[model samples]
Target chain A: MHRIGDAPKVRRALVSAAVILSALFLLLPLVAIFAQAFSAGADVFWRNITQPDTLSAIGLTLFITVLTIPVNLVFGVALAWLVTRFRFPGRRLLQTLIDIPFAVSPVVAGLVYLLLYGRNGWIGGWLDTHDIQLMFAWPGILMVTIFVTCPFVARELIPLMQAQGSRDEEAAVTLGASGWTLFRRVTLPNIRWALLYGVILTNARAVGEFGAVSVVSGAIRGQTNTLPLHVELLYQDYNTVGAFASASLLALIALLTLATKAGLEWRAARREA
Target chain B: MSIRLKNIAKTYGKAGRGVSRALEPLDLDIHEGELIGLLGPSGSGKTTLLRIIAGLEAADTMSDRPSSIHFGDRDVTHLHVRDRRIGFVFQHYALFMHMSVFDNVAFGLTALPRKQRPSSGEIRARVQRLLEMVQLESLANRYPAQLSGGQQQRVSLARALALRPDVLLLDEPFGALDAKVRQELRRWLRHLHDELNFTSVFVTHDQEEALELSDRVVVMSNGRIEQIDSPEVLYRSPANRFVFEFLGDVNRLEGHVHDGTLTCGDARLDVDLDEGSHELLLRPHEIKLDEHPTELAHLPVTITAIAPVGAEVRVELEADWLAEPWLATIRHADFERLRIKRGQRLYAIPRQWHQFPAANQRSIASETMS
Candidate 1:
């Protein structure tokens, strides 16, 4: 007996349509980036990557991603733990607040931070007295990248931790485990997979953040220009090969992230089986 | 260790809105090495009381009388669960999923402060001994996800016992297992409790489990203790209507008594009672089915269903007088002698009955048919 939508003709048609659409829309663009980067030969692609501004852009992007991950990891774990484990007056409201970074446009979030911390802004004027420059600098780019990537870890964790419940933690405490010991030995082990998945997502978002960082970085060549901003700069300058080379780098990182995620999921499924 | 609870109560949610009472102010004393069972239906606060005793929840503080808990001579009302030295087994077996059976059981011992932590060799020996006691020594390397429900529960029990806690609390320890496994685990837990000689209290909704495993059963309903007595006393003489009904299957006879005869619909029984409205309760075993109406009763009933799977045959009886179906359990010999079958009409004779008067009067009157 055939199940719903399981007729041979219809199944073949649907499967072919999905495969063709994915190949054309998703796979074509990824292949084009590397192809275009190497169109002018490997020597020009190598020269473009070795440019001073391009090197600085890569360094700044790596710095921001490195800083953003640890900060958000701590914040996300703490927030998820608080929301899932305890009952408070504003718990529902706090849960809603966690989605602000995801709900609002990244550019709008960058603007909000700029309005609060930029020169001539409310807190920025006070900071200007102290000569603490935040906006139009590396700190500004890092802050906005953190803002855009804040929710990934927490969003990945909250539902999983909620489903798992606090019973193991409660049992640990009753067994004379101290606060830190319980978190390390019981809570951490239980949440390690989800936590790792969340960290992977946060890293992906942090590395690829463009809209918010672009709005704040001021695009100072070799100074605040991250990889995405530098690629746009190269494109406008008619350096097509250089722009594609940087895009290829970003695509490589995305592919690596996807592969790692797939590997983790396969391992988790095998463990369950 | 013996346990004491004084004026313990719990009110959930914030005051004024969404507030509900979970437990009422009550006191209880548990003797050392005693296995007590808190038996009640769902939402009866049995699990809440057990959690409170485990320090997982705090009892409300009454201004007039402060709530307190004591373990032997130690006042532990405000003590943290980690410092109170108690072990709790969750209903779901809350075993650490990532840890092997050996690691799970050795967790509490290894988690002790460095000063009090046992040596690795000693911890290993203890965990092996616990696994041997639970008869899971061969499965020590398996994770919780790889084990069956019964196995996971045994691991949970061993983990709870590894700490050598003064009191061990289990919340519906066997509620998640199959009937056969539940029975086996119940006997095994009793044996372990007796051999170890540690105080334990468990919560359960199954009456047979509570009656079979507990030295004394605390029957509860609506957040109050209806009675606390040994299983034999609790079964033989329940304290109130709630206790009697909650303990086991009960058949109700609601009618009016006139001139020592109680009549309900087309049924009548010679009952010793005042001339007024009365209700009587009868247990399944107290009912006897006969082919002809007896002089004392004329409770005509039809066998709606019959189940002879267990040691005793259970027969379902229904009549125009009953608001609900009644059950009568008889021996296999009697079942064979009567050759009872479904749709067969029979007379129900009450060998014994109990009566509780109306509101404002709390007393039990037991009568036996002569």
Candidate 2:
């Protein structure tokens, strides 16, 4: 007599059932988006994606991603190095604060920035006196995007850097390597893969950000509306085909992000081996 | 370069609360072109002392005790590791994972400032020469992950020496290798130390590694240096009981001494001592096995085991008087003549024994058996 948990047939059935259910739960919506996107044929899909406002939204999304990723890359590495390598007062507090952006709701984050930088807000008066517009403008959009993607890279890097310890860096220092040389030759190469992973995640999140950018964007046509906000506008106009088409664009980006992530993970595993 | 450590100490945590004193105040001077081994068990602060000299860790500072380190004439206590011109080989070879062996060795040479840096060709040639010295020229194109542990360690050595550092420090350089590979690397290190003629300090807990490799061994325990001597002197005349025990296997005989005789249980030995309790120490080879009881320091025992290998036969003996079993190593020729076997009754006569009044006592009062 076999134990119920030890039976191979039962175990295989249970595993297969769980996997199939989860796959359907995750994949069904993705498949629906694409099917509805091309349902009206390629011409309608192309027309929907190439509309002047849609094109500008896509451009705005790309612009936010391109600008913020580099900024986050530098900030993440510096923050990871500072938090992992040095011993100082408030280190634990600083580390905890870095993850606050990830925990905060994006809408709440947008509201917080609006309260600080909006035209009539705290820094707003100083900015208005200087005739600078941040609220409901491109700068406000950029600021909220930066806030949303802030923690991605550093969160990936901090634990890995901490676990690697300071042995290799110490070794480099003893060999007469200057600080810049130590970071370039020793530290960067070690953390490069994790850094790439963080950039990818940050790019995906920045491109797909909806609530935070919406709160600050003012949604002016072809001005500050990102791709997700444009999808909202198209849906609000009752243009079902156009809305899914734009939605499909974001979905396609999500798929590409997942593929790249899996590929990088495989490369990291092989490198570890 | 000659090195000196003056009044160096280290402590961790707060003074009044949860605190651990890692190192006590110490002073040491190492001569130029000499290879010294810091030998101790774990938590003995041997590695801590080596790190302090390499400038990886700072020594403690006190109002009255100021810590300072010197390399030749330069006072390097406050200097960073890069400016101190030292080279360190970690126990786990910390070779850059993404770079080839050639690139790893060339790291230091290429990292020099522009005015002081060597040309690309010169850097390549220098790296190749160092790799040749370590016998890793064939694997120069391979990454660290592609090489074996011993091969990785050889690359580490080549990389350390590429900069022509004033002082080279290795922390358990061969600790990660198997026994055979460890022996091979030890010989290689000794050869390199001599040919290059650089001052070097290495830390190890293995007594054999310390004794066989260093010109001088600094025996350490409990964050303090117990003795500093040539290996030959250390083995023959350990400065204290801890050193003797740490260096090799030691047998002990404990009893009360009255007049010139020491008695414990049913055992009696002729010892030169005043009336008091005494403990005697003997190396395995110092004990003699005999069939008849002698008038000297002899005790009756039963042969528990005999393992004859190569030139010597190791015999294990047990008696009521011994708190632990005693081992005696005799020649193969003697083993054959005596026909030693398990379960046979025998007498162990210690040819010589050393006595220290306490564990930390320095003077060794010895007596010879006739």
Candidate 1 ranges with C-alpha deviation above 4 Å: A1-5, B359-363
**Consecutive 10-residue window with the lowest summed lDDT within model 1 chain A:** A186-195
Interface RMSD of 2: 0.7
Q: Give per-residue CA lDDT, model 2, range B1-370, as digits (tens).
A: 8999999998878779788777889999999999999999999999999999998998998779788999999999999888898889999999998899999999889889999999999998999899889998999999999999999999998889888999999999999999999999999899989999999999999999999999999999988989999999998888888999999988989999987989988888988788988888889989888888778666888899988867888899999999999999999877877788899888888888887776666756565666
Tens digit per residue, CA lDDT, model 1, B136-162: 999999988889999999999999999
TM-score for all predictions?
0.96, 0.94
Point to the candidate with the largest TM-score: 1
Q: What RMSD, rounded to one decimal, does every model reach?
A: 1.8, 2.3
Query: What is the Cα-based lDDT of residue A248 in candidate 1?
Result: 89
lDDT of residue A230 for candidate 1 = 92
Residue pairs in clash, model 1: none
Which window of ten consecutive residues has the lowest lDDT sum in model 2 chain B?
Answer: B361-370
